[model samples]
Target: MVAFTNFAIAALAGYAAAHPGEKHDAHKMKRELVARDNAAQLGARSLASCSNSASSQALKARSIKRRANAVKNIRQKRGIKAPARKDKRTLEDLQKWEAVNHNMSGTYNYDMFTSIEEVFSGNTSCILAPEITNGPYYVVGEKMRSNVKEALYCDGIDLFLEVQYIDTNTCEPIPAVAVDIWNCNATGTYSGIATEGNYATGGYNSTYLRGIQLTDGDGVVSFETIFPGHYGGRAVHTHLLSHNNAQVMPNGTISVWNSPVSHIGQLFWPEDLRAEVEATYPYNTNTVALTTNDEDMWSILSADASFDPIPQWVYLGDDISDGLFAWIQIGINGSADYTEDEYYGVAAYLDAEGGHSTGYTIGGGGNGTGNGTTPSGTPSGSLSSALPSSSSA
Candidate 1:
């Protein structure tokens, strides 16, 4: 009886030791399963949040696109035709009407109209010239001649131009014209600002870095300046092209003078620069950044079909350290007679680094008031009074 009792006790102890390890393993596995489930729930929630934000952004973009399309339709309904070439005239002939009118008035506030030196501060000095060309190539001549320069800054970039040509019919290119370029410094602040009866003066008294150049035969123009910085509410861009002209005849005969024909437009940076700029502000909130080759409000409205894939007439190059340089082409059509083909006018091209390029229409032949006004509230007919022409290369 004693030996039987001993054997029973020993067997019970052995079994107890072996089962404890198995129980511990089961507890560990249960904890792991609970952790995994929690992680999955968190991941799903994050994904849902991202999806909602993207949907909201897409809706906003679609709304803007619809509005732009509506504007295009309205212009078409107005019987606006594209511009084409007709006659040619000398600079004196083009200026004849202005000489006679002498009463011709334009915006001349210290804020809007300043000298070239005031526009380009902290940059080098340079000059751009214009030449003449033929066919679609004439657009290049216009751009090459315009002494407009693009500057990049922290707040935003500025494009300074003396002149630009906008076809009244199709809102396309008008060649063989000069444009003056100028803008604020790197901080997106313009020159000649007055505060508390004290004027804020920095660079040249006459709009710094501002200069004029004529369009080439191919309707191209060029400029010398620095890379502009990005500002709030807009991407990195420039302000340029205040005055532009359109030729009605090939022999320099009948010409339409659109003085102070404000052409306000801007150039955007590449994806890399855009990303950096958006990180700054209001732009950061924009979800469109996710998409490649995104277009802004101005781009969709002013872009032309011919400017696609980059215009051959446009060119861009720079020393990087010293300063930047750019060239654009403008083509003017519809001098002799307005035709459907001529109504569309010509396309301008731009060439920049990284193979990035874009184009916009030149001559939209519509007689409308531009944005610039004199200090006395008199409207200026200068091309600079409206949206300036733009190119990205």
Candidate 2:
């Protein structure tokens, strides 16, 4: 018994030495294990076909009209002349566009929508693949609002993102479903988490570039923010989580833990678009190596014959720098029961003051650690209040 106790003590001490300042929480460890299992089983649940129904087409038509009218109003206010219609594009044109390489050395001049007819005739189908993981930085209980930019004068081209949620079971729009999105700034650092790595700067008290919005009657939610910057080893993308029947707490944050996670996926950008955006101002300052769509494994899997995960986007003006308006229809399984702990791949949780470690150790993948500094302040009504009493790091 004495020998065994000594051996155990030595092993515990070695583990402590290996991971400094990281507490081991059974709850968080279990959550991570469950999330991995979900990833292996999630592919079976993904909807393989992105074909649209008549009802879905009608819903998309209304959404297109709404966006067109909004764009028209903006054009009128800017006093910009309408763009001239180009030659009719064939399947060969689409093939060439999708095959655009990142190493090209010329200015890109592709515009998806220049006229109302072109906008109406665009594809409205959306992929329902749950193949992409929620990534490590997905935090629960984000503030409920539309604009996630947090009014910061951040660098990068302005991006207007619109997402429409559709129920795969009924092929109809899903209203009132909550959608959460978060991404890095122009410098490739995410908000609300600090770590011992270079991936994310420690900003636990900050909530920039993160927010949640409920889908409107048309099952649409929009966010006004900057184009996300690229991080090393991963292509430029935005993380998204969907909650169905989740109640917004009095503090204006959703209870992601208790609510069912209807969908967990990442939205991707085209290689050409990413290259163009990264070549411009502050984005060019990010020294991390860019990962093109062809090189990233996840980006490859996100594409198939029946579905394409890339969002349909068009410039808000004559050029890419003028800003962009992008939209994507996401089909989700309404009955797929998943909570934050199951499929979220959560690495950290943001407390009322800043962010707190979940005691889940991020591997050498260098996503980010949960060692965020706790800012001293009076805890206000935020996502922390929505957490259960048992939820503590």
Q: Tens digit of lDDT per residue, candidate 2, span 207-246?
A: 7888888888888898878899876656688887787776
lDDT per model, in order? 0.27, 0.57
What TM-scores do the predictions have?
0.32, 0.71
Query: How does candidate 1 score on lDDT?
Result: 0.27
lDDT (Cα, 0-100) at 53 in candidate 2 = 57
Off by over 4 Å in 1: 1-175, 192-206, 242-264, 273-295, 303-325, 331-371, 377-393
Over 1-393, each residue of candidate 1 has an lDDT whose tens digit, in order, gives 011133333332322212111111223323332442343243333333442355434533442343233323423454333321111222242111111111001111112223212212101100001111011111111223233333322222222121223232333334555454443334433332221221224311223333445444323344544344333223344444323453423432222233323232333334443343345443444342132222222222122222211111101111112111222222222242211221112222111211100121222211121111111232343222122232110
Clashes of 1: 152
Stretches of candidate 2 exceeding 4 Å from the true structure: 1-54, 74-97, 100-117, 120-122, 151-153, 199-202, 340-343, 361-393
